[model samples]
Target: VQISKKKFVADELTEDGYSGAEVRVTPTRMEIIMLATRTRAALGEKGRRIPEWTPVAQKRFGFPEGSLCAIALRYKLLRGLAVQRPCYGVLQFIMESGAKGCQVVRAKSMKFVDGLMIHVGDLVNYYVDTAVPHVLLPQGVLGIKVKTMLPWDPTGRTGPKKPLPDHLSIVKPKDEILPTTPILGQKGGKPEPPTMPHPVPTA
Candidate 1:
């Protein structure tokens, strides 16, 4: 089978009681041209030179300094999405351990969308360190109960809600332990130490 810009052509092989036939599949003209153009552009010289840009030139090509250029290429080629604009705060956070980033930033915001399954009043759990019994709520910890699910906008006073800065405040659910019946000597009483048998009287 040969796939061309305009059509897919295949020569049928004779088997059983069937006659050999030629098969052809032609796509729409626009789609064919679009596919062909993309193919040539990708497989031609332009594709090879894309990776040769210097660090500075690469920045201009939509990659941040010290960031993964390969990720940008993959995003463009596979997802058909533009490279993410550099978040200097996030970049600094990556380079310097103590550096701080934006107040509200998600590691991978693109993967999640609005209208997730979590609903209001659902139970959620979060863990705390053994030493520290109190819970420590991070900026974006998962498994947090949804307090209030506001609409795109809370009130009509504000304009349309922006995509970023998700306005949900989450809380950890209270710990609930099932009550158990205590053993006769297990609680509020001491277990009797093993006692030696009194010496038996001589027969």
Candidate 2:
């Protein structure tokens, strides 16, 4: 269950059709998950505060007037959940539990009552080497839970428990629709015109 980084040499193709040797680094499962969780946190902070009339806000939310309150609210909700810490904790726990290899699946959706919910599942396989007999254990699943503590409710009490809606159910990333799809067009409808691509610079 030793976690360490490794690098390997790989062939990469350039635009000029020249094949060259490249160092393709493959991070461990723990590193990958930690990086991803941190990225999520960083993106979640974009809308933490209301925007003013600025080019940054216009480019980010597409509305310099701060009319996109929904995005800001969603960001606030996600920040409260503190996804990065919990996700990393889960991975560390799995490695400590004798898992040699692990894969994490992340699910993010806004259909929950709390505005945003992130679910993580770790699929792990391990083997025990002992003098008695070497035994390979079957794949196991570990789930991570993220809870928020409200200032008003110090005891961390939750409201009535209700089943998650179908839309909120955890599903594979491939099966989910892009978040920007709705902004582009109606459901199942033709997407809006594509934005012009930036021209590549020439030497």
Candidate 3:
């Protein structure tokens, strides 16, 4: 993952909307997952860039030739997730893409959240590819936090044992209700308002 980031950033491809990357390494092979907003620019014409990138990845990581596999995918934006209503499809997508486990949480409330609600733990801090992107809403701007379990390997070089954490700190922003002050004459209120003195007492 570090090698991939360096390569993309050096080539100035990050300006082309390169979000980030992930790596799955095993005794036999290494998998490079590249995510970008502009896939066409990042991949070049007909994905010729992948071949160009593969050699460097293998050399930098000291992996054998042909043992390095590169894949490019479009990074999902917060706006896109919001349009999905609940984002269960997102969880399913990641799980299908070799992820050991995955979870998506929108800070805003929804009738049907295919994943979790408010969570509390240090689970998200370990072995998770956590992303909290913001989106605009009628109420206010909110964040959609995604925690994907890193791909695991038997070589023990992979991330923590529990990649898919069970808890998150994301929660919906509560509306603020200002405390109203009661009328001075009313009970449980402030002291009565001061009265003006009689006509300045002979002017």
Candidate 4:
């Protein structure tokens, strides 16, 4: 089960309207996952000293997790479908594997999610200057995800979304985009910035 398709960012139909969830354009460190191909990031300014990517749960639906694999060189989960969303802030994704090899993988959402965000599109501001973590690996510990959009939205509705730039898409991989920089250097080493639009998880 090798990664068949991947999308760093692309245009998508949000509840508010049409906007681009540019994962690369917006500056937010993220930890991406392969199971459902989800992207998540921190909320506070002083995020975390050591980011964690732990598997929460797993169940054999039909496919084999042993076959699911991440690209050794890439930093994002592979995707085979464009504009993919399972449910509830995107519970799963489609693998469009072919260019690299393979065809497709599982259907439902991932079994495990370590500190994955539930739906944080509004707070994903480029001007805010955030570091989103993304998981580059599949099974084992992967690289920090540099993403903008969060995966879980308890309400399943992205709060207030902004008009995406003419060239941002949540379905395409464009590492060319850069994250916004902090307001100032640690000259005085003051307190960290405030966390905007904090997402409250619903049990």
Clashes of each: 0, 0, 0, 37
- In order, what lDDT does every prediction score? 0.28, 0.29, 0.52, 0.26
lDDT of 2: 0.29
> Candidate 3 at 10: error in angstroms?
13
lDDT of 3 by residue, 18-72 (tens): 7777765655334456678897887677555755765665576665321222121
Please identify which of the two predictions, 1 or 3, would achieve the higher lDDT against the true structure: 3
**Which candidate would rank higher by lDDT, 1 or 4?**
1
| Error of model 4, residue 57, in angstroms | 11
Position 199, candidate 4: lDDT = 91
Best by lDDT: 3
TM-score for candidate 1, residues paired by index: 0.16
Question: What TM-score would you give candidate 4 relative to the actual structure?
Answer: 0.15
Residue runs of model 3 more than 4 Å from their true location after superposition: 1-82, 111-124, 137-139, 161-203
lDDT of 4 by residue, 1-203 (tens): 11111132111112223223322222322223322222222211221211111111113122112112222112223221221221111122211211111121122232222232233354444211112223324455433221223222235333223433342546776679665875553676776777899799999
lDDT of 1 by residue, 81-168 (tens): 2323322322333325321111212233532122222222322111100010111233332221111122233342322233224457
Candidate 2, residues 85-179: lDDT per residue as tens digits?
A: 43444344434533332222233331112222223322111111101111122333222222221111223232113322332555566676557
Ranking by lDDT: 3, 2, 1, 4
- Candidate 4 ranges beyond 4 A from true positions: 1-142, 146-156, 165-203
